[model samples]
Target: MSNDVEHAKRALRAELRERRQLLSDAQRETAAAAIGARLDALVDSIGARSISCFLSTTTEPGTRDFVARAAGRGIRVLLPITRADGLLDWAVATDDGEIAEGLHGLPEPTGEVLSPMAVNDVDLMIIPAAAVDRTGMRMGWGRGYFDKTIGSMQKCPPVYAVIYDSEVLDSLPREVHDQPVTGVVTPTQTLNLSQTRH
Candidate 1:
């Protein structure tokens, strides 16, 4: 990463960390409900049978409730594993379970990792981000893990970014390796970019 991009990432990360800390219990509960509703709407819109979604950690948006809801409805769920080289490898979550602390202090599946599935096999993928724009541009944690992983997929699934409505901003600085989401879901709205060019 260039020095400028690296600096931008660091600034964004700090801003997000501070933002997370400022949330009151009531605000967090309301935000979680809104996020959950948006997720449900997006899932219904896609009508996918199987999905590959991240198991969100506390530092990120809460996805456990959403994942459990999906699993209850018979949708397959997949969580990512960070490989030795900092790339992501996905595996299906065996059953309803809690997030186990893993690399970078992110939450992952506690169950045994299942056989790998082709990316195209997943109908949808929910991505975590620090910030996103209306045009589907995402600002991630600067690791490029999702970018590399998504690049390898023959058929890219409908990518949905989960963020607070506040995180959707006017624009975010971009780099060549930055991957864009196909859709964005906030507590208030779900913006579909597949039909609209960014």
Candidate 2:
């Protein structure tokens, strides 16, 4: 990653963070409901019995509704628990799963921890992103956890990043380690941006 590209990503992330912060509580709820519906449809279309998803922070597009609904439908939902070594451990998402502030103050499941390789069986992955470009290149929130996970998977599934509709851009700064997703799920629609789904 060149210094210029790194600088650009940092600036863009800061701006996007501010934009998310500006959204009112009502706006967040409406967007969360819309996004959850779209995600449910996506899962049905893919016929994914098991999937990996991230618990959204307050500023991010809410995914708790989708997670809870998915678990209720008997679709095994795995939530990522961030590891100290910059990797993610998996935990099954339960309707009554307790959430605790983990490393970096992110929400994590307080259940029996599974290994990082626990994500291998997931049929799909729904991850977080600062933004994603039209080409599917995801600009994560300066953390390489998702990038590393996607890159390391031997039989990676269709990975989708959830963001606001406005966060889907024409282009974004990409580094060599930055991984592209198969699609993006926004409040209004789900866009499949890559042909590489497996």
Candidate 3:
């Protein structure tokens, strides 16, 4: 990454950390509702049979409800597990009983690590991001897990970023390894990048 891009990422991270601290419990609930609603719309639009998403931690935008809703609707939901080498492995999440702690304090499945599935098998992948740009570049949590994971796929799935509306920006400094998302859904809107120039 260029020095300028690295600096911009750092600044954005700091700004987000501060902004997160300022949110009240009620505000967080409202934001989650908005995010869930938008996600529901996206799911309806895509009519995907299977989807993969993350179980958000407290510091990130929570998406547990959305995941549950998808599962209830018969979509096969997958969550990313952080492997020892800092790469991602996807595991199916059918019920609350399947989850356990993985590397770096993130959640993973207690079940066996299945073989990596083809990107075409995954209709949608909801990614976690610290920030994203209108052009679809994603700024993750300083880790290259998602980048490496997406890079290894033979056919990339349609990637969607899950974030608060405030975290979406006009531009974000990105490196070549950073994979751009196909669309970004916040509490407010879903920006389709397939037709938008980056």
- Decoy 2 TM-score against native: 0.98
- List the candidate 2 regions with Cα displacement exceeding 4 Å: none
The top-ranked prediction according to lDDT is: 2
Tens-digit lDDT track for model 2 on 1-198? 499999999999999999999999999999999999999999999999999998999999999989999999999999998888999998999988689998989998888889999999999999999999999999998979999999999999999999999999999998998999999999999999978644
Judged by whole-model lDDT over C-alpha atoms, candidate 3 comes out at 0.79
The regions of model 1 sitting more than 4 angstroms off are 114-117, 194-198
Per-model TM-score, in order, reads 0.89, 0.98, 0.90
Error (Å) of candidate 3 at residue 163 is: 0.9
Query: Each prediction's Cα lDDT score?
Result: 0.76, 0.94, 0.79
Write model 3 residue lDDT over 101-146, tens digit each, in one string: 7788886666556655533388788889988888888888887888
